[model samples]
Target: MGGLLLNCDIGESYGAWTMGLDAEVMPYIDCANIACGFHAGDPSVMRKTVALAVAHDVTIGAHPAYPDLVGFGRRSMVCSAQEIQDLLHYQIGALDGVCRAQGAKVSYVKPHGALYNDMMANPAQLRAVVEAIARYNPQMPLMLLAMRDNAAAQAIADEFGVTLWFEAFADRAYDALGRLVSRNLPGAVHHDPETIISQALTLSRGEALIASDGSELLLAAQTLCVHGDNASSIAAVQRIRQALGKTSAS
Candidate 1:
C-alpha cells in the first residue's frame, strides 16, 4: 500500500535477436513499459508483449523512443520539435491500438533512451513530448526521471492537465545533483543485487541517496525503474520486491 510503483522497460527484443528476460521480470513489476516500434520492438513483439502484460494483469505503458532502431534508441538525433511530436504520437497510437485489440489500455507514456534524457532537461523538447501526450490522451500520465525540487516539468504537466509520475532509477548511480550518472562513465550501473536492493529500499523509505561525491541527494519519485537489459536484473527486481515486502510489513 506504500506509494511505490515498480516499472520495467520490456519488449526490447527485435526480430531473432532477444533482450531482457521480460517473461521472468514481468511478475515482479507493477508496470510494463512496452517498447513501441520506433525503439526496439516490432508489431509482432508488441502484440505478444501486450498479451503477456494483460495475462499478468500488469499495468501497460507506451515506451516511445526516437526513430533510431540501429542505436536501440539510445543515440540522440537532430529532430525538429514538430518531427519529435509527430513521431511520439505515432508510436503511442500504435501501442494504443495493440493494447485495445488485446482489451488492455495503456495507462501511461514514458519516453525511452535518448529521447528520455533529452526531454528531461530541454524545455522545448519537453514541451514537444508533453504536447504529444496531451494530443493523444491527456489523461494518460507521463513517467519521467525525477528532478529535485524542479517545477518546470511539473508546471508543463499541469498546463497539459496530465498526471506525471516522477521516476527514479534503482540500479543506476547518481551524481551530487541527483541526476543520473552518465552511462558513458564507469560504475554507472549497480550490477550487484544487494546494492540494487539496498538502493531501492532507501528510495522506497523516502531516504536520501549518497551520490558519487559522497553528498546526500533527495529524489522524490512515485515510480522506480529497473532496466530490463541488465544481466541478473530479474534477480535484482525479485530482491527489491522482497525487500519492499519486508519493509512494508515491519
Candidate 2:
C-alpha cells in the first residue's frame, strides 16, 4: 500500500481557458501527468504545472497524445508508426525541458486518451510508443494500465528495455476482460467516494475487483489514478490518501 504512487492528470489548461484544479490537487498526489501542449496545455501552462509539481515534491510525467487539440486529444488520428514516435518524442522533450528549467525532470511517460487506448489494444502502436519512450530516455518509466492480461505489452516493454508502471483507476469501471469500460457506456465513470475509495483499497492490496458485468479481476498496481480536475474527484483524492494512510498504519 505504501508503495503505490497516487497520480493525477493536471496542467490541462490551454491559454486562458483553465482546466483542472492543479494547485488544489497537487498536494494530495505523488505524480502529476502534465499535458504536453498536444491535448490541453500550452508552454506557459506546462511551465507553471512543472513548478507546482516541483514545489509539491511530486513526480512529473509527460502526458502525450496524437496532437488533437480540438478534440482534447481524445480523438484518434491515423498516422504512421514513425510519425507517432516523432510526436511523442516532441511532447516528452517539451515537458522535460520545462521540468529541467524548474529543477525537476520528467520521471515517466503516459499516453493520453485515444493514443493510450489504441496503444493498449494494438501491438504495433504499442511497440511504437515503447520505442519512442526508450529512445527519448530509457531511464524514465512508462505508465500503463494493469489488466488481467498484460503479458504481451510487458514482453514488448522488456524487449525495448523500458520499465512499465502499472496503474489502476480509482473512479473508473473496468470490463470483464479487465479493460477499462468505455466512456460512452452508462455508469462507466463512478462518482461515489465510498465506491472509489473501496476500489482504491482493493487495488492497493492487490485483491480482486468486480468488473462492470460483475466479473472479477485481480489487478496489480504500482500506482493508482484519480481524475482530479473536478471538485468532487479532488476531494476523493484527499480521502483516498487518508484511507491509504490508515491502511498502511493498520
Give the candidate number with the greatest lDDT: 2
Question: Estimated TM-score per prediction?
Answer: 0.95, 0.96
Show where candidate 2 strays beyond 4 Å. 246-250
Error of 1 at 56 (Å): 0.8
How displaced is residue 167 in candidate 2, in Å? 0.5
> Which residue pairs of candidate 1 clash?
none
lDDT of each: 0.87, 0.89
**Candidate 2 residue-wise lDDT, 11-112, digit = tens:** 999998999899888988898999999988999999999988888788889999988889999888998999999999999999989988878899999899
Candidate 1 residues lying further than 4 Å off, grouped into runs, are 246-250
Question: Per-residue alpha-carbon lDDT of model 1 for 1-250, expressed as tens digits?
Answer: 1478899999999899898888788778888999998879999999999988887788999999999999999999888999998998899889999999988889999999999999986889998899888888898899998866658889988988888899999989998877789999999988887888899999999999999899888999988998666557777787787777723110
The clash tally of candidate 2 reads: 0
